[model samples]
Target: MLSGLLMIVDMQNDFVTKNGSLYFPQAEKVKPVVIDIVKDRMKREYDLIFTKDWHDPNDLEFKRFPVHCIKETYGAEIFDDLKFIIRDYSKINFVMKKRFSAFYGTNFDDILKNLSPKHVEICGVDTNICVMYTVEELKNRDYDVVIYENGVASYDEKLHEFAISQMRDVLGAKIEKWRSFNAQH
Candidate 1:
């Protein structure tokens, strides 16, 4: 049986690039960590997944957040640095999410049912929002979740730290440094 699943969440151009509508500077630093996690997961032969924030032009989420990552646009595409890597990897489950939680309006549950991974490891953007919400849902579903601390960041430093703590304490997800996973495998 496969021991783990690696989920790269919301690592889209809109969240990672400087000129994006909702650009956060910390996202640049987190990109390399996310890339490293992807490479490690590739070597480990675990089920790999990516969650994209594929919003519509009139998405209701635009009321609270800035309009970004519209479907079929460059902003909705994966960050350039990671795109080629994912492209080269043949087995990737791409989940297009309309909401903060990937499982809310997508085929994520079906994919999980098929893979049946022993644990899920997550890494991606907006530690306080999409990442946090997805982690919560995974925990609710009783999946053993491990979040890569160095691979997650948000626009607000306070909220990022708060979300990390909340996931660790309240959600019961394991929070570990990304380097440790590489060292182990």
Candidate 2:
């Protein structure tokens, strides 16, 4: 039985690619690592779940950050490289989120409940923001959350490290390098 879920958070063009409006410097570098993790997990008893920031044109979040990931726009789409691997949406679930945390204003909680995963591994961009919030929420829901250190990135290096530490120490999440985690699974 598939009791593990791999959550790829905000690996969309706006956060992970150069052409995006809110692209992070190290975001592109984590792509290959995230892809490798995905491929490896696909070969295991783990299901894939991708979360994208599908914001409304007039979303309130625009006041905090630059306008990006507007619905139906290229910025909101998943990176081209990752899109190819999603050959079947039925097997790979996609969750469109409007806020920083995937659990807010989305059916993410319901989906997580339905899947009933024993563990959830998270990977993606802006480690200090979206990824951090998601981790906090997942932990609050009592899920065993694992963060792939090498597969996630942040524009600010210090904040990235801090977020990882917070998730590991405060939220009680397991932090591991993608290669190390993949090797075990």
- For residue 77, what is the lDDT in candidate 1? 91
How does each model score on TM-score? 0.96, 0.94
Give lDDT: candidate 2, residue 27.
86
Checking candidate 1 for backbone clashes, the offending pairs are none
Off by over 4 Å in 2: 180-185
Which model scores highest in TM-score? Answer: 1
lDDT for 86 in candidate 2 is 68
Please provide, for model 2 over 1-185, each residue's C-alpha lDDT reduced to its tens digit, 9 standing for 90 to 100. Answer: 43989999899998888879999779867999988988778777477889999988999989989999998999999899889876654557888988889988888888888888999999998899999999999999899999989999999999999999999999999999878444666
Whole-model lDDT per candidate: 0.91, 0.88
Q: Model 1, residue 60: what's the lDDT?
A: 97
lDDT of 1 by residue, 61-106 (tens): 9999899999999999999989988787876999999999999979
Q: Cα RMSD to native, each candidate?
A: 1.5, 1.9
